[model samples]
Target: MTKLTLSLAIGDYDRARPLIDGRVQVDGVDLVPSVLSPEETFFRAFRHAEFDICELSFSSYTVKTSRDDCPYIAIPAYPSRAFRHTSLYVRKDRIKRPEDLKGKRIGLPEYQLTANVWGRAILADFGVMPSDVTWVRGGLEQPGRPEKIALNLPPEIKIEQAPADKSISQLLSEGDIDGILTPRMPSCNLTDPNVGWLFEDPTAAATEYYKRTGIFPIMHVVGVRKSLADAHPWLPGALFKGFQQAKALALDLLADTSATKVTLPFVEEQLVRAKELMGDDYWSYGIEPARPTLDAFLKHHHAQGLSSRLMAPEELFHPATHEAFSV
Candidate 1:
């Protein structure tokens, strides 16, 4: 088999380190992975088709898939997954509860971001529909943030652009926006006492959410260029196996408490608790195992008008990556 060398833009996650470092191989493919932040990777990948493979936003991918003009075909390898309970930032005075966000001016980096999709889904569970809040879109810490892909939001969902001179951080601090649904805190949040997270203890909220709905929000998935996948059909499955193996290696390293692989204390305790709540494959990569989460995301994606049509879990990835044959 001739090995194809391709550029892959991905995050510098511990689970994906093995693949980038050459410790793991993707069948016959030779990967040249450039680890980058989600913002840069997803933006370039969608905007310019910059890399052959990269981590793409699930919401954006669903949106592209619906249009049937997607340049990339997704794989089952989800490199990033979080509960998203900590994603919201609200003024302590105006927004005390989730329902209080109704009719408020809510700011976000982008409406179609994976984190925003999950955040809206959770908020809707509390009876706050996407149309309920007036959406203010802009950068979180800086200026000139735009949606990764085009969106045709429904008539009821009202969205406005933030002034080019200001960012969401400034908007929140000045009380121009009542709250923000974002993946991270505003820039002034650390220095200013006026801005704070909507959920004080997001971990507790995430745990309770998991307990209630059994949903672990997925953020990003591996995407391969559709043309490349079409030319080399084996590539998708190979990529899946490589990522799966890389994650397996990381998990094994996590269990090795002898040297304390990470700087964080209570590694063993947190691992035990996480496993108890989400099971061993909490950071899972597959169709069947993640069916519920995928289905939930697709439902919210369509309900929120991120997708023109309701996409299925199976439609997100290449058909070959769905199942494997074992000896």
Candidate 2:
């Protein structure tokens, strides 16, 4: 039998390592994986439809799917998940709390990014609305970042593109911007004492957030070209199963702490603590288990004006991926 060979674009994630290295295989499919930064992967996938399967930004995918004209279909296999508490960085002396972020100039790599969406949602937790901030959009470390697709947002939201010559990092370093919301650590924060996390200890905030919301935020989902899923109805579930198996294998290896596979210390203790907080399957990818996080994100997407309409979790995934037969 000939396997369906498809191109897959994803980030270099521990969960995806098994699939990337061929330790886990998608049934009846041969995926040609292209591991790259989330920005590059998402940019190529959304802008040019460059991959048959790709790790996609949940926010942009929500925007596209809600239009009823998206070219792709997603499985609930989230390749990236991070608590947004760490995504906020502020000038050490300027913004002391989330409330201070209101009416302040906040720099972001992209206005519609998943990180920013969740960041805004958390800010709302402290009484800051999306419309309250004056937003500056630019690359994190480079210049000239633009929205991948057109945005039809509410008039009240304030967004301005940074000057073509300057990046968000540059603006933050020069104290031109009060804070930055980015998925990665800002370049200026590493070497400068003046730039620090909005939360001094993000772990505490994340723990508190988990206690309040019971949500470990979902970031990226795996998408296939809708046309491909339409033509080959079996593909979506097969790929989902493959990704699940890949994640399972990765986690199984992580459980083996006798010799310490990862370079970081406290691997065992951290794993135990995470399970204590988030349960056994902490990084779950199933539709049933992810409903709350997905629901919360949909609400945020709508509230932030990223989506033209509120999207239901049921409508966001491929029909073929909704269920699986167990043996």
Using TM-score as the measure, the top candidate is: 1
TM-score of 1: 0.98
TM-scores of the models, in the order given: 0.98, 0.97
How accurate locally is residue 158 in candidate 2, as Cα lDDT from 0 to 100?
A: 93
Candidate 1 least-lDDT 10 residues:
185-194
lDDT of 1 at 17: 97
Query: Model 1, range 1-327, lDDT digits (tens) per residue?
Result: 679999989898889999999999988888988989998998898889999989998888889999998899999889999988888888887788898899999999999989999999989989999999999999998887878888898999999999999998899989899888888867777876877888889899999998988788889999999999999999999999999999999999998999889999999999999999999988888988888899999999999988999888888899989997799
Q: For candidate 2, write residues 1-327 as lDDT tens digits.
A: 799999988888888988898989999899899889988888888888899999999988989888887788999999999999899999988888889988899999888999899999999999999999999999898998889888998999998898899999999989999999999899899977899999989999999998888778999999999989988898999999999999998898899998887999999999999999999999998788988898899999999999998878989898877877789
Model 2, global lDDT: 0.90
Candidate 2 global Cα RMSD: 1.2
